[model samples]
Target chain A: MIPLIQAAIVAVFLGTWQMLSPALGLQFFFATPLAVFQSLWALMKSGLLFYHAGITSLEAVAGFLLGGTLGMGIGILLGRHQLLAKVLAPFLTAIYSLPKAALAPLFILWFGIGIDMKIFLAGSIVFFLVFLNTFHGVREVSHEQIAILRLMKANERHLLTKVIIPSAIVWVFAGLRLSVPYALIGAILGEIIAANRGLGFLISSAAGRFDTAGTFAALIAIMFLALVLNRAITFAEGRLMPWRAAEEGREVPI
Target chain B: MPGPTAPPSRKSSEALPLIEFRNVGKTFARGALEAVRDVNLSVAPGEFLTLVGPSGCGKSTLLNMTAGLFLPTTGEVRYAGAVVADINVRVGYMTQVDHLLPWRTLAGNIAVPLEIAGRPKREIAAEVERLMTLVGLTGFGASYPSQLSGGMRKRAALARLFAYDPETLLMDEPFAALDAQMRLVLQVELKRLCRLLGKTVLFVTHDVDEAVALGDRCIVFTSRPGRVRQAITVDLPGDRDLRVLRYDPAYLAQCGALWRLLTPPVEPAVAPQGRRE
Candidate 1:
């Protein structure tokens, strides 16, 4: 029911946009939604859209995996050892809060205008989000729980894998959910700065040529991919944490 | 003619007290105030002992010292007559909160201590199954802590505690968060389990009735800067059911006595000073 209403609103927006484009005496730079769809169809026929999407998807996935894993590892370590957390916390927070996009020029200069630069940029953005969330998750574990485990004669390894890791899993997933969009954004921004391939490059090239329909086509493709990725994350979350879903439903009217 | 009552047996050599704290004193330097003063207590093997006191009485501080979670300021806490140098693995401490890991299922939570101890996979599986059954959580092994009710979570915590079979169990108001009926049922189950396992148990609670219902000996402590006020040994037959014991005259008397000891003395308020109009 909600989806139907949302679709109707989107259709109304597109209908109004198509109606106004011709009436306003807009230049060729402003394309109607039908023209954008036609451009998308042309790209699909040529298979260039698929090729560029594949590159962007690869960059996003690689960055997400690398960043999420490294973030979780360091976060858990910092969370467990107070001395380590205190020593590194300031530096980490400083790096995390810095405008990462401002460093795109530096990354491009270092890694060249290849997929590597895009991957690096995206990974950095995703990493900080995952790291902070994972660290907080580990810290949130109850002292009582640790005390109980200690009394059971559990060794250090046992404490980490069982208590620490399991406790932080939810937080890690939360970070992942928040960072998924960031992953796409980072990849696109990096590609926009300097790239020969990817949806970002397609949009940039199209805009430079004054092909408004082609630019809109690239954006539609990016939006579709983002939606797919978001749905995948939601599905994974539901499978991994049925209990959390049930608990949330009970607590809130929604 | 009536049958004679059985003679009390001497403390078995093998069943000697496992954990004992002699003149143990803990003082937290809260800027200036002393938190706990001199205290002494013993936990006999196979006996259920409860420390009952009002809030801020340092009852939890005392338990923490015994669990080796915190060190004493002046005196020593000994496990099996040896000074505790580090966190004692021979004791299991369950805090007032259930503390079940939200991410793990019932079996996963129960298997935590075993997992930490590096037990073999088969052994961990067996132990998890055994504990689930022991805690009456047979069908709910895959259920997460969030899916459990308050009483069930506490039971899961107990199963986690029992996973390693610690000789001495230190519980700090484990059921204090539960509803009255749930608390009563769990208390009864805990007493029965302690007797069966022959574990030395030191349970801390603020409830007088709970102390009398569960403990073989109840140790009463004073308010802040807590000190041992009295130790009362319950004279009821060991195997008697808690439900039935509530109706017994002797049990009522013991409960009444412990309740009186717990209630603070009344003091008259001083009259306010008046100023001239």
Candidate 2:
């Protein structure tokens, strides 16, 4: 029902856009949704859309994996060890708050329009998001639970694997959910600034040629990919964390 | 009226006291304030001992030391003749809150200690099953801790403790969160299980009746910067049920004595320390 209502609202907005673009004598610079869809159809038929999408997807996936792994590892370490957390917290926080887009030019300068620059740019953005959330998650685990683990004579490794990791998993997943979009944004932004191939390049090139329909087509494709990735995250979260789902179910009675 | 039919054995003599706290003093310097004063207690083999006192009395702190979660500032806590430096795997500590890992299923939570101990797969499975049955959690093993009721979660916590086969059990208000009926049921089950396994049990509670009902020997302590007020040995009928013991006059007297020891003394009203009105 909610989706249906949303779709109706979107349709109305698109119809208004279609009517206003030509009525206001706006140049082809502002494409209607129909025109965007038509151009997307053309791109799809030419098979270039999938190729660019594949490149973008690879960068996004690689960035997400690298960022997620590094974030979780460092987060858990900082969370578990008080000395390291205390020592590195200020530095990490400073770096985390910096504008990620500003760093892209530097990355591009160093890596020179290659996949490494895009991957690193996206990875860095996603890394901090996951790291901070995971660190908080691990730190927030109850002292009482730690006491229990200790009393059970759990060694350091067992404590980390069984108690610490499982305890932080919900937070990790939360970080993952928030980081996925950042990953896509980073990749697209990196591509826009420097790349010759990717959805970002496609959009930039279309804009340069005043091909509003092609730009809009790229935008729609990005949105579709983002939605798909978000759903995948939700599905994975449901599978990995049935307990959280059960808790939510209990909160609101049917 | 009769003892067990099994013949007595020399092995009983070798059963050492599971836990012994001698002149144990734990003082938390809240800048300068002390939290627990001099205290001494011993938990005999197969005995149920309870530390009961008012809020802020450091009972939980005392239990933490016993579990080797914390070290006493000025005394020793020994388990099976060895001084406790770290947590003893031979001891099981149940906290006031169940603290069952929310992410794990009941069985998974119960299997935690076994998992930590690196038990074999077959052993972990069998032990979890046995503990579930023992705690009346047979069918609820697959359910997450959040899915269970408060009483059920407490039971699962107990099962988790038992699964580790710890010779000594340290409980810090393990049933304090449960409803009255649930508390009673668990208390009875705990007592029965302790006797059956001959495990040394040191349980802490603020409730007078619960302490009296469960403890073979009850140790009462004073309020903050706590000290032992009295140690009373309860010699109730060996086979008497907990339900029946509630009505027994001796039990009531013990409860009254414990209540008297726990109540704070009334002080005479006087002028303010630094101001005069």
Best by TM-score: 2
Candidate 2, superposed: residue stretches over 4 Å from native: A89-98, A102-112, A251-254, B1-18, B22-34, B73-85, B176-189, B237-243, B246-249, B259-277
lDDT of candidates 1 onward, in order: 0.81, 0.82
Docking class of 1: medium
| Runs with alpha carbons beyond 4 Å of true place in candidate 1 | A89-98, A249-254, B1-18, B22-35, B175-197, B206-210, B237-244, B247-249, B264-277
Error of 2 at A192 (Å): 2.2
lDDT by residue (A1-254, candidate 1, tens digit) is: 99999999999999998988988966385799899999999999999999999999999988898899999999998898999889987898789889889889999999999998889899999999999999999999877777767777767776787677777888999999999989998899999889989999999999999999999999999999898888888898889777787677554332
Clashing pairs in 1: A158-B116
Restricted to chain B, the TM-score per model reads: 0.83, 0.83
Tell me the number of clashing residue pairs for each predicted model. 1, 0
Residue A254 accuracy (lDDT) in model 2:
41
lDDT of 2 by residue, A45-117 (tens): 9999998998888899899999999999999999989999999978998998899999998998888888888
DockQ of each: 0.50, 0.64
